[model samples]
Target: MESGERTLITLFEEIVNRFPHRVAITAGDQELRYRELDRRANAVARRLRESGTTDEAPVALFLPRGAELAVGLLGVLKAGAAYVPLDPDHPGDRITWTLKDTGASHVVTVPGYADLFAGSGVLPVLVGMDAEAEAPSLRGGPPGAEDLAYVIHTSGSTGLPKGVEIEHRHVVRLFDVTHPWFGFDEHDVWALFHSIAFDFSVWEFWGALLFGGRLVIMPKPVARSPRALHELLRVQGVTVLNQTASAFARLAAADDGAERPLTALRVVVFGGERLDVGRLRGWIARHGDAHPRLVNMYGITEATVHASHRPITAADLDAPGVSPIGFPLPDLVFHVLDEDGRPVAEGVAGELYLSGAGVARGYLGRTELTKERFVELADPTGGACRAYRTGDRVLALPDGDHVYLGRTDDQVKIRGYRVEPGEVEAVLLRAPEVSAAVVLAHSYGEDDVRLIAHVVSDEDPSVLAPRLGQLAAGLLPEHMRPSAYLVRTGLPLTPNGKVDKARMPAPTAETISAPVAEPDGTSAELTDTERRIALIWQAVLEVPRVGRDTDFFDLGGTSLSLLRMFQQVNSEFGTGLDITVLIEAASVAELAQRVEAARAVSPSAP
Candidate 1:
């Protein structure tokens, strides 16, 4: 790409021209080669152009994981528009707000979601239907390097999600800088495991498409199940893979019990959450580090997905408790500074500030916040430059690497998603029954961190628990939902009149919402299958008891929790459960039926 002409459209066109017959994406049994994907995307681009969407317009993609999603993303970019992906699993209210917030004039979805935006003002471009029709040519040239490519909405402390406006130049430079470390080629096959709503997907998609590699789009169920995902990696011959530490830990455990190791993999990248170094030592003992090298990265959305990369070696296993994230990319620069804006010493801990080629344009339509977080600083060259305040604390190593500590703000990471306690608290307070709410992250076991919401309300804790759970289900994403709710008439306050979080008690096992009896005030009866599943749910969901009819989601069971439950279920029943099994089973009774059917169909040895 030329200096000022680098753009997704330009780069993608080059790939299409280079490898038109190479398979670009694989979703289920359907495979789309480069030429076909380009044609499909062009069809979408034509529809958007006909819909009057101009360059740099924010286009909402409200589709699930499938071929249509891929078309919508590529098509939006082809139309010179920025795509904003919306998780279909999220509540309708949140999706509505995101569309309104972005002022999106167009929404790309399938026929299944036609009713979702019947009277909504935006023009709905149904992918399956619209892309098949004949349309007029696009109106203008492709979007430039400086134009917005995507707006990723992350958790905001102000009770809503904030859109981080990333430009094409930022993303283009990302691969340019990191391509040396990862010599990705046409022979490589990658997995689109994470949701497109998350910034991680940016790397997943571009990393494969840019280098003419095949990208396998994992189904929702397959992505959640460690065993299922490992099987897919082996069967699909996946070479390049990226995962969060929490998710990879489960995959590693699954690999341990597998009959054969996945030998096709060339590189395994870890990011999103902190790494457990001890876990890697165990993996290295089995797989060794030479073939499929381990690389740990630390990054944020504002920095266009990744900032620093640390290649893991046997020596890194003995680096004490610190997670050393190696050095920043060539195009990016990092500064560890104190609150006074002065640079801290090499070994001192301070806030991490990043600046360089990948620094985002700023928060969408939020000038005040853009000014506050994205501050101007003096470059080493003695000129002014923009830098993003990461809000994470880290200390520079003697070798110029940075070791991650923890967050310095109210923000926390749940699974791989960056969650804001204030956002969850605000959602809780939306209910008239909740007067005051506080959400905090609590660690139960190793790598089992969850959010617990403590509320001050007049209603009884038992009665309020279900109501709060239902309310949260309709207002926030699964990761943002509180696992447990603790109610109090009034919270202990400090002399300063602020709620003293130190005095508040964590939810004890007894206080957790556990079903003791049936709704009819009788003792619950469970079959053998139900009992086994109930026990698994009890451990994974952190509830003392799971009734026959207890809804898995009502208890704040997220996808990660469901994954943990599936591992135990597969171990006990030897069913190797697929996600479709859970399609009819959101409760213990329903799941037991599915489990029984699965066990009878293809039971394997435990």
Candidate 2:
């Protein structure tokens, strides 16, 4: 491709022509060669074009993660339209909101997911249903560099999701700057572990396809299980892996005592949330800095995907507080500024602002918000450009690296998903039983945070907690769901009468309402395996006692806790089990049953 031709499709096409026979994508047992992928994507593009998708128009991709998703994304771009990724696992309300916000006329999905957009007035074009179809037109070119590449919706404070419009050039610039740093090539295998709805997927998806690398599409189940993901990395010889710090923590913990879990990995890029350097000590000790480079990147969806990169070292882990975000991508301008927008002195904490080629166009349909957050500033060359005001508070080190302090706003990232606490609180207050609600990000483990909802309700705590959980499950996505519901007669207030979040009680095993069977009632006795599991839970959760009927989550167990428990179970029982097994089983008795079943089949079982 020519230097000036930097659109995603053009760059992708160059790679496709260069490596036609190369394996482009691997999902489960299926593999698609570059040539076949191009042909399939072209066919999808033609179908999208025929369905009235025009230049820069949003086309919703509601398909599950697989070869079809990869093809469908490329096809949308090829059809001269920006793709809006809708997570198939997202709540229907969220999907509906995203579809309506993007005004997408066409949706690309697989079978069984057609119902996701049934009444949304979107024309569903199912891929993989007929794979042998030919393209109606292959000569049509992709959209211009300035045209929209993708519109990613992020949590909004206004109780609705806001779409961040990123242009093709912005995406191209991101790769152009980071390509040398990552050293991606056709020999490398990248894992698409994140949901397509997230901006991180942009890096994982195009980073592989544009560089002629093999893209391994992680199934939802495999993505959730750290053990399974570790096995997949080794099995598939994955070289480049990107994960949110929360997710990486689980993976790193799962690798404890295992023979070098990620032997094939060359670079592990962390984003989405702040990297807890201390939590990754186990990983760094297992594999030193020379083999697999561990990088902590801080970014926002508004700035394409990533803005800055920091190569973490074992020594740097001891640096106090959160890991430094390091330096900005080449040509990107970052400033730590005070409330007055003036640059703060070195070592002073201030809001982070970024301006560069990677800066996104603006929010879709929200012009005022776009102007408020994305402001025009003069460049060093006396040229005017836009810069995004990242709500993150960072302290600039003398060495040029910035230490991520925390968010200046209420926005918190839970498992890499940008969540507005108010958005979740709004949903909570809608419930008839909830008189008032306050949602906050509570840290369960190191750098691991979950949404905790404190609700004031007239109903009993036991009755209201489960009802609220059910309400959240229906209205919000899994990440947004409250890990623990603390029902209070009234919200704790400070002297000023404002809800004092600091004064709020931390969720504990006793405070969190669980399905605890009556002690005098018909509670099943714990089996040996169940007894061991209960002991593990009791220690992990710090609860006085864990009964067979007690739910792990209700006992303040976060995803991180589950990973820890899973690691313990694997070590104790010598049985290979995925973390999803815990999530699926949920309760103590159910998980014990699964453990017993696995142990029963194991030849090593006593």
Candidate 3:
């Protein structure tokens, strides 16, 4: 609680005063200590104040995931304005979208991306050694308890993204609660795995600064690569390994090449998804001598990073699936309630609501949505305490903990049966041949939600598709099986490194020929040539199905995918459909006729 007086500004003051000369951040061969970061941040902060940017204004940060981003973020906070992080690796459209939405007055970016925002009217402040050392123009007022610290925008599955406004008090509370749990000390060296845009990076940033520990920011390539991450762990002397479940799974799945003994790993914190305990045990079993502590954290962006966590051991893995997220932080309260707003019995799945100081103020400029998701506790302890309905389905376990069920909205009804798409996708990903999978409700007049598998292996979808369906049948319910299987060299990924479902291809009627031949098959019969062309449509648009009259772009097909499709047709069928044909003849029937006409041309018809 003493840290309450020490806001973002105070935290930096403490570091500059106490550990000025201590090494603060290290990226590549470059090293910066506390005193340098403090001085640079002050200069940037002062420059910001002179520009009339105050506490309420948001400054956009488009620096890479390294020291520049760290400095810029701290500087923006020092200027008493919230910082909006846009990953430099993201597409220009994504960055432009966030910038325009946030209404950021100034953008701090490298010289490379300067031209990307040319017409945005945002003042570009280039980050370099000079900007870092410039003296702060004037000291800004300190941030208040409820003052906005930062705004993190989450990709909305349904529509445009919404920014979650986090306050200083929320950050303070998270640090206070998690500090005691981790028992971090000045000697700790934690690996920073997440991008600056995500809220979890706050944990890696403040967690280190608050405890005077070392923060080793992994290079983007190293962070994404399992082998590189494993190597960094051994080389960097990372005592605390924090990553998402996806990252953990990859690390745990890696083969035993030259075992990089993770002897220094005191704690491994995993979150962002349901971790497979089987893989956890298997990973530990192979590296038994390492004896690292495994901690599972459960939290939301609405809450300042993490609110609950539990440590796991080899013995705990033997009991069942992944363990329940333990009780809330000491200063927080987590309740499990049923639909009628009554407390549920242990082992009964209910909506998990969180009440704590760590809950964020609300969504930025979205009071309606904020009030909808975060409501007053049905069982109130009086006074202004409000509980955030996490929209997460969880249960009170017999062991006095909470088990995380998938999201309530996450489950979709397919053919009148409820199916968790994530559950099916998890099974699909488990197949060594499959690199990624996504299941969505594909409407074909029957409201049949089809499962789509995007495999990276060289195996043919015709042979592998049936085998995968068989595998799913054995492991999942009949309704959970993917109606159609599609294989690709790679799955489309958004700039944020998540599966870009919107970019997935459309399913053409012809590609479903195999199942259609079986009579009970949902697909209609189409010939071999038609089937081959239909596959091109599915691979390009990422849609569930293409009707005879369905348009291509209307189904989320893009010009880039169309170009690739034209090339595929040329290589495989000795016919290249005019790129303009996609626009002129949007429907499959029209496109098929056009393709037939194209085939009539000779190779010499340039």
Candidate 4:
């Protein structure tokens, strides 16, 4: 298929015509063949056209991750409208903000979420309501190659999120340029493991459907549990897998005792965060570099999804510390420029600027921001071309690879999610008690990072901590929420009166209150299982002592730490428990009850 010849919908139509009877998507027990998917999407497009959707206005997809999501995406494109992805897991206010900001005409969602847009003034089209409707006669028309395909909202330095308007040609160019090098075919089974709101989903979803490959819609719980993910990879015969560096580390660590773990996986693409090549040593030792080639792609939302790719090998792991982000894609050009916007010499660290077909149009409704970040550069060939200024500090190696230094701004990536500290700080300041606020990311482990909030308030630390946490929970997503909340009388300041982040003290266990004594004034005795769990929590959380009633998260345990805790429990007890169990039982005492119940039902119970 030619890159500029058609939009994604037309390209997908061509594939559907060729492979109608083939299974296109699978989620749990539901499977949709290519023909059926096309017909269903056409029906949805008919309904959307009736609702007055157009190429200029985008439709909001507020559905869960399932076959319906795939249908919604294709259906919106078939209707000649860009689709705005909305994650149901985001806070209600965030969703409402996005819905209003985008000014979408309609939202495609199940009945359960219809109430979320109740007062938002947008129409909701339930998935099953018009299942028997006729397919749209105008399918795959109106939208041109340069038309907007989707508007993905990303974190902003300002309090609100900014929508990135990406065109069909950019997406087409992405697959067009990378497909030949990656060699993705119909035989490959791709996993849609990321939230649709995240840019990574763009590559995962389209890379499969556009290539005539079977796409597996991973359930949310399965995506979170490494063991479950490992089993799914084997059972579903997933050939091409994509994961963030942190998530891949968990998956690799979960394969401790398996002889041939992830052997079915042929290609594993790592993106959304820095690829710490050292973390892959265990997986490489077990499976070797021959199968499931590891490719690290450094990218940003503004630049479509990916900009460069580097195939990591065991030899690359032996390097001291630096992991180089490989060369840019054929259609894209990257330049390392100094503060003056002049290109820097090779090996000099500077801000990276990207110019290419994959570069997005600009931030929606943010004209000044778009102008500042996306600027026109004088091309050596004579005409001026636009480039996106990536606030990343990178040094271009002599061999053409780029070594990632760090960020030039306050943006920090937590678990592969881009977080602007100012955004979190803005949310923190919304609380009435907060006089001043600062949010920062701190290293929880070698490969794990967590956010922490430092606030200045007259209120007592014990009194204000929980309120701030509650506010954050109601406002921010899980990744953006601060793992630890520290209250200070006043924030440390530099000589220039700016908040001195370097002088901020790290949060300690002392911030957490000790577990209360038992009802009868005596300490609660721990059972054998409880004792084991306590020990594991202590080791994972780095706490000196853990009481039976101690909350894991309250003791500074995060999602990564919870995974390690579960791994330890599974190893010690020989019991397979899902990570959600920890979420359900936030305290050791409650978790002990769950463990006892599972043990009683176990076939090997003594």
Best by lDDT: 1
Taken over the whole model, the C-alpha lDDT of each candidate is: 0.84, 0.81, 0.68, 0.81
**Ten residues in a row with the worst lDDT in model 4?**
512-521
**Alpha-carbon error at 146 in model 4, in Å?**
0.6
In model 1, the runs with Cα more than 4 Å from the true position are: 128-137, 513-528, 536-541, 545-606
Spell out the clash pairs found in candidate 1: none
What are the clashing pairs of model 2? none
Evaluate model 4: give its TM-score: 0.90
**Which regions in candidate 2 have their CA more than 4 angstroms from the true location?**
1-4, 129-131, 136-141, 378-384, 513-539, 542-590, 597-606
Which tens-of-lDDT digit does each residue in 354-390 have in candidate 1? 9999999999999999999999888889998789999
- What would you estimate as the lDDT of candidate 3? 0.68
Please identify which of the two predictions, 3 or 4, would achieve the higher lDDT against the true structure: 4
Candidate 2, 1-606: lDDT as tens digits: 565567988888889899999999999988999988988888888888777777888999988777899888888898899999988777777788888898989999887887766666899987752556455444346678898989999988988889999998898888888888887888999999999988999999988998899999998767765667778889999999999876776577557634556778899999998876877777777788867998988999999889999998888878646668899999689877899888787778999889988888999999999999999776668887689999999988888888888889899887788999989998988888888999887776665566678888889876776677667777787777776677888887899999988888667767766432322224578888888888888778755456687556545566577878889988888888776666556677888888888888896864
lDDT of 4 by residue, 149-230 (tens): 9999888999888999999999988998898778988888999999999999999999999989999999987786666777
Q: What ranges in model 4 sit over 4 Å off?
A: 129-134, 137-140, 511-539, 542-594, 597-606
